[model samples]
Target: MSTTPQSPAPTGMYTPGDSSAWSQRYADAVMNTFGAPQRVLVRGEGARVWDDEGRQYTDLLAGIAVNCLGHAHPAVVDAVTGQLSTLGHVSNLFTTPAQVELAETLIALVYPGLSAAESRVFLANSGTEANETAFKIARRHGGADRPRVLALENSFHGRTMGALALTHKAAYREPFEPLPGGGEFVPADADTLRAAMGEDVAALIVEPIQGEAGVRPLPEGLLATAREITREAGALLIVDEVQTGMGRCGAWMAHHLLAPGIIPDVVTLAKGLGGGVPIGAVVATGQAAHLLGPGQHGTTFGGNPVCAAAALAVIRTLRDEHLPERAAALGRRWSEQLAALPGVSEVRGSGLLLGVALEEAVGHAAEVRDELMDRGFIVNAPRPDTLRLAPPLILSDADADAFSQVLGEVLTSRTTREARA
Candidate 1:
């Protein structure tokens, strides 16, 4: 496939004139959790998207790092469409070739040294579901008497009750109080994590790179120490790679870069796994793989054939195209350019997953993000001083240069205006 960038379509599939009608329909039919739609995206191809106003924007966020292959890639479309036409779904009562193959692929990717039989997979429909399943498996592994779980601060696991309890944010957890019993927060330090673990603790769940926390990569040696402490305490170390897996962090798994021998007992994945279609997986190693048994956990839509096919396609595409290596090279170049820009205090993260921090808290990261959108770029502001960029792994040097130029302009202009004021 040619990597040549494509121009944005002359017109969008939707129009701004229809915004009110669409907004009304969304308000009446959809839930209010996400508040208002940013812009009614009409269509997309590769790294570009068109909004309701027919304005085009380079998709730097990649649908929150879900569109690994970019919008409507031929591989994803063909896999999903072909699978849907052939066999859409068959519940857990039966298994399909794609489902089993996807499980094997994930196991190989997550635990390269482990055998397929040694690592079992339980597929779900989203990242939260994957974490939810891992939580249940941990609880079961420690038996009914042991239910406690230790989670790191500034961590985000998921929103479901089980996953929510493990999530560290108070605001997101407090509203849905009395979540599952036995989940505690510890500082991301190894000592704090060791201090929190006990015999009754079932697991220590953590993100190798905390995506929602402005892409904060865990400090060196912390993950290795956490693994040792969890094993000593007989607690499972669960790595939530939901946002960091599938070559997003320049490796098949971000933890691989930190600690080579640091394999977690349980690994949860989602986000870019299926390129865009929803697919979540929990891969368990050693005895943890068999803890769930026959009837301990299951999902209605989990491991549906169509979703599995999509995941297989994504995995194959990553390997065939050697995207992980590409991501590593591009990430280094992009981070260096970003750090060279004026007012850019630091650039942290691996692969294309990066957080650019400014010298001063420009209370307007969001405002600047909006401006970037207006200027035909898409980025995200996870915090007042931090801007995250998780573009598609397939993005080319030209795309990286374009993003750097626009980002430099945005930062320089903002800094200059603030100085004037």
Candidate 2:
């Protein structure tokens, strides 16, 4: 008598092999936060993916540096599927072996010199959420005495309220007025940072290598200077490794790679931790580890068994395969190759996380990115003049060489067009 579409509306079904139809359906059902879908990707494997129309692409962006192991890696797949079948999930009231092991493993691996007693891990659902947790810790640690937090200009923490407050971009902050407040932006320089440091500061949060700001590395010794300043001022130093961690920059954490022995009070991590599965972590050390009391912070699905298992598998695979060392070697060689391109001005960043700076006459990064897309390579332009390539750590040398050739062709075509015009 009653027909409610049986809980599966006609519009709910997606059309096979038709990107247009899927796009229409997506517009009707999904929010327009990310605008139209790029290609309606169907599946992926080993740094490559196919869209609904069957056009394939080499995923050089690697889901914005989140797919470190590439798409559907066997280790991640098996770990996720197996653990999901066995334990699946449980509330924070209880703990799973995977959860405990993941926490321990992160401390042992990422914070090598620091002992377990001196460090702790708090897992969350995304880099944003992990940064949110860190924000709370900073606030709690500072209390009423220290009210200010420092973030860099052009820095991107996240979109959430707390994290967004720390993000220094006006476009992302102005619309959302009266934010959590107390967040200030400072230039990434030792002198500027020391001038900003004071007894009123709670923490100075920074990305050792600014990923969104065109893969820019902070001036050498700036972090060590920050370490000394924050220490002397009794403030916490939070390193955000969301975009540069888990071997993306040839090390477990970019801070360790850049600063060596200079340890921070807190380290926020995500993106590549679960390879592809959603997971994030906050690594706090020394007295900073005990800042958040029991009931002060928690997450519903942060370190659930299945996600934890996936993260554990990712860590194990990265270590076993020596992927970090591979990233360093391959990235250096490939960077030199890209830097040699006529249109490229500079190749910034280290290891696999690189941002290629484009020359004025060659064309803006967006146009070049589109050209690359047409040629079956997927990359993104975070800035007008820069193209970021964060291919999976498993990227083959042959693929890297092939990509260089394709890029050469694309730039050459642009050059030819300009000359004709």
Candidate 3:
């Protein structure tokens, strides 16, 4: 290997072949929040990654719905590198051209009916920050009269205190009790939401598709019901599109496709927004747009030029390449194909985001996930029986077919062995 650009000081050692050493080093330094690293991935190109041992795997998870355009896409590379080199960061006090452009672009996509002047954007570093900002916006909009913020059950927002309060999962919340207060979960049903939403409510947040709930798309008209209920109750309707936005579900924003003609007061974004460069946004419209005002909220590195540029590139690439349409086409075809497999009983979700429900005979999804990993495929098991697939928008048909074929073999063998046992 050629090594010419050595650091003037000393660079940390990186072993290309010794993953165990790197894993130990990581455990020694990094926090154990995510349990353990799945693989010591060194580099990636388009929908594939390589470990320290140079073993390759098709990356179907796409960094948990963040890498929309896939790894090292030229547009994102050019925009991020160019912006970083020239004008990387200026404090929130000083806005860059890229920041302004990205905000407008997001508004256009999130609220196409509303003019840029009618909407406002608060940029942040991740999906969690975006949800945190949305939480604050709900409080500001509701004022003292309305302190109740309602989210749907089985929802997963960011892990921060405020976002966690809005998240419904007990395991993710009970450990960190006393979370800001007033955030609660309502059953994800129109009847329950209608009954729960009242004059005292501050806001109701809903994900068009509850991603952490294993890519489960909300029942049709759910967002519409939310919009109407919240509107009647004088509460803001916040759509947490962190995992479903930026062309993940074959649409720029899943809400647009799932619930057309209904407008949300606040929409939180991240994940694919920066195509893996780490950026998020809270886009608010109408009355919600002016709630924060000055000094109410701020961030140090939010909307830095580099991330903004990266987001703009992702958005532009999506539109220019018609990737959302492609995702729609491929998602439908792949879902049908996967559903026909002997192991899969049902398939859920849209665009590239999918959840395959394994039959009971096929064994747990985690066990199957490990089997697939061993066969050079990287996927996610969000639930015990559901395998979530959020592959890159640019994923090739060949990889999709290979994954399906391998999954079928794994499922059949597991089923046969289980039947025998």
Q: Sort all candidates by lDDT, best to worst.
A: 2, 3, 1
> What RMSD, rounded to one decimal, does every model reach?
5.6, 3.1, 3.2
For candidate 1, lDDT tens digit of each residue in 273-369?
9899998999999988988878778899999999999999999999999999899999999999989988788998999899988778344678778
lDDT of 3: 0.90
Q: What's model 2's overall lDDT?
A: 0.90
> Model 3 over residues 1-421: C-alpha lDDT tens digits?
3223233223434446642465656676789999788888878899998887888999999999999888989999999899999998899989999999998888999988677887999999999999999999989887889989999999999899999998888899899898998987898899999999888899999899888898898998788889998999999999999999888898888988999888899999999999999999999999889988789899999989999999999999999999999999999999999999997899999999999999999888999999999999999899998999999999999989999999999999999999999
- Per-residue alpha-carbon lDDT of candidate 2 for residues 42-134, written as tens digits (9 for 90 to 100): 778999998777888999999999999999999999999999889998989999999999999989876896778989999999999989998
Candidate 2: stretches off by over 4 Å: 1-20
State the displacement of the C-alpha of residue 220, model 1, in Å, after optimal TM-score superposition.
Answer: 0.3
lDDT of 2 at 90: 95
Model 3: ten consecutive residues of lowest lDDT: 1-10
lDDT of 3 at 404: 92
Which residue pairs show backbone clashes in model 1?
Answer: none
